[model samples]
Target: MRLRVDLLPHGQYPDVVLVIDVLRATTTAVTYLERGADALLLTATPEVALALRGGEDGSPYLLGGERGGLPIPGFDFGNSPVEATGQNFTGRTVVMNTTNGTGAAHTAAQTGKHIFLAALTNAHAAARRARATATEEIAIVCAGTDGQVGLEDVYAAGVLAEYLLAMGEFTVDDGARIALTVRRNSGNPLEALSSSGHGQHLGRLGLGEDVRFAAGLSTSTLVPALTLDGDPPEGTLRFTAG
Candidate 1:
């Protein structure tokens, strides 16, 4: 198998793609599933998420997302793993639209045969899922902060790659190598995150606890995989535990 990591969202990915947004998005996604959320509908914008929740489709969905790393004005919950930890979402779907992660997931769904959300919280499980499902290649796509590559996401990708490399033989690209190097040079997960640009920004906003929560490695076994309900663009990327 071949492994490649995209420091930022790019062109077509391999057969299996893992999306990472360690500062928050992907971590919150895994937490939602771990807390019994039936499904997560990822939207490109907050407007779309709100529309879906208020639509007459009869599907009950809770609006959850963040803008500028803060909870949206009308959202039921922010893109926070810590907040999601105490909530029970059984039999309900969450419509999420984040500043970075949702857009990256949408891009990957356009070409990737299989897409899974990854973060420091569930690195091992995400890597195991990719190894078991990917036939030849796997791509780890990082949802950088506001279009530029975020150190936090790259570090999480390295963690995922490390687990994948341990499980089997794979040729890695330079992007993956860079991620590995970052992981090697970095301190613990929380330290790595707290030192990053985005992480520091969140800290300034009083969201440092979320970063600490996201730093936990191999803390969860749930792997959230994306499955489209319809075609691309118009279709919805529904993620569920796999």
Candidate 2:
């Protein structure tokens, strides 16, 4: 029950990789999936995502991503969870690229082990699942903004660490402790996020409301786990049965 938390660089390790992107890739993915999007395809590069959309055999995928906190030109949607929450993506696959979230996914995948997509939305369920896996260690990957620690992402990771702690069996690491401490220290979590690097960037683009939405804790119970092909799995919660 050893646990370690690391920023994107820890991606090379052989541990359960939990990718967190609070503002707001992972958050948006979980919202879309829970609200009925069929699947989400995480891509490292915008070119790869765009190429997949144009490929003849590709599924009808909507291109979603952001660069510098604004929607990439030619993308169908911005990387805002609020924007994604409204659609009934029942059978459509969302192809996404992001400043941090998606890149962490690819990096973590390099470990060649199981990976899970996490955010405050699915914190509890995800931690429970990780504990059940019987792995000696788990690495919670925080997708900070531009390789620098971002409050929202670290806060989300802390939420997961707290959840795992509540389970009462796993050993926590210093990184995990830092996550929990930071999350608790943000006396006014949403307010604290309004000043983060990503938050400020989104603010400049008139996306302040989205920052508030993404900062919420436990808004949904769905856990959007990554599958072998980088697409979200069929079920909303990976550990749940049909």
Candidate 3:
């Protein structure tokens, strides 16, 4: 097996891809699935998500996501894992659009045979799923903050890599090595997240609890995998518990 990490969402990926956005997006996704959300529809922009007001049959869809780490004005929920934990979505579908994470998922879907959303909340499960599904290669793609690399996402990638390396005989690239190094040097998930640029930014916005919630390592065993509702661009990317 071969393993590599993409610090940003660009370039071709391998057979199995794990997308990480530890600051909030991917973390919120895991929380939503764990909390009983039926399905999550990911859109690259708020406009697209908003356009999806309901299913084909007209059942209402809940809107969720953020821009600049703050709640989008018209969104029903911000990209907050903590807030998601307080709601029950047993029979509802959610449309999500964020600053980074959803776009990363769309990019990976273009190449990856299998794509899974990864975060500290489901690091172990995501790694295990990749190990079980990957036949030859695995790419860990980080959804950086505003197009720049996010340290929190890298740290989460390292956490996933640590688990993957232990489960197989995989050769890793420099990116994977860098993630591993970051994981080794970081104190803990919360500490790493709390000190990150995005984390601090969230703190100033009074969302510190979200940072703490996202720092929960292996708290959830659920792994959300991407599935297409139609085709690319016009099609929707939906995440469900895999």
Candidate 4:
């Protein structure tokens, strides 16, 4: 198997791709699944997220996400893992539209066949799952902030690369090597994450709890696998909790 890493969806058609957004997006998603939400659907933008469901029949679906790290005006959740962990979303679906995370996932959907959401929270679970797949290639796509790379995402990418490389079957490129080095040299996960631009951005918004929640290393045993529930162009990815 071959391994590759890129920022903000470079598209490699790997059998599996881990979409990392450690600042909060994917962390919130994994929390949603672990907290008992049935499925999490990703959308490129807030408008598309709203377009997926509207009017009187929007019941059983929760509107969640953020713009620029702040809660959207009408969203029920704002990409915060701490908030997600505190709520009870049993038997519901979360429709998400985040600034960068979901957008990166949407871009990855175009090429990756089996996409998984990865964060420090579920890094080990995701890594092990990807390793077991033994796919021809595995791609680590970092959801960079505002069209540029973010330090936290790269750090999470490094954590993921460590486990994938440990599987002893894949070859790593320089991008993957850099990520691994970043994680290896990162002194403390919480400190590194808290000092990141997006982390501080969220902290200023009083979402410091979310940053702390996302910083927990390998705290979960869940791996969220994306599955298409309908046709393309209008298809929604159902985050399968396993």
TM-score of each: 0.95, 0.88, 0.95, 0.94
lDDT per residue as tens, model 2, 65-125: 9998889987889888888877777777777888888877777777736677787767777
User: What residue runs in model 1 are displaced by over 4 Å at the alpha carbon?
Assistant: 55-59, 229-235
| TM-score (C-alpha) between model 3 and the true structure | 0.95
Candidate 1 residue lDDT tens string, 32-60: 98888988889888888877766466657
What would the per-residue lDDT of candidate 3 be over residues 35-61, giving only the tens digit for each residue? 888888888778887767734555558
Give the per-residue lDDT of model 4 (tens digit) for 132-235. Answer: 86458889999989999888999999988888877786788888988888888877789879888888888898888888889999999898888765342364
TM-score between candidate 1 and the true structure: 0.95
Off by over 4 Å in 3: 54-58, 229-233
Candidate 3 backbone collisions, by pair: none
Residue 200 of candidate 2: its Cα lDDT?
Answer: 87
- Candidates 1 and 2: which is better by TM-score? 1
lDDT of 2: 0.75
- Pairs in steric clash, model 4: none
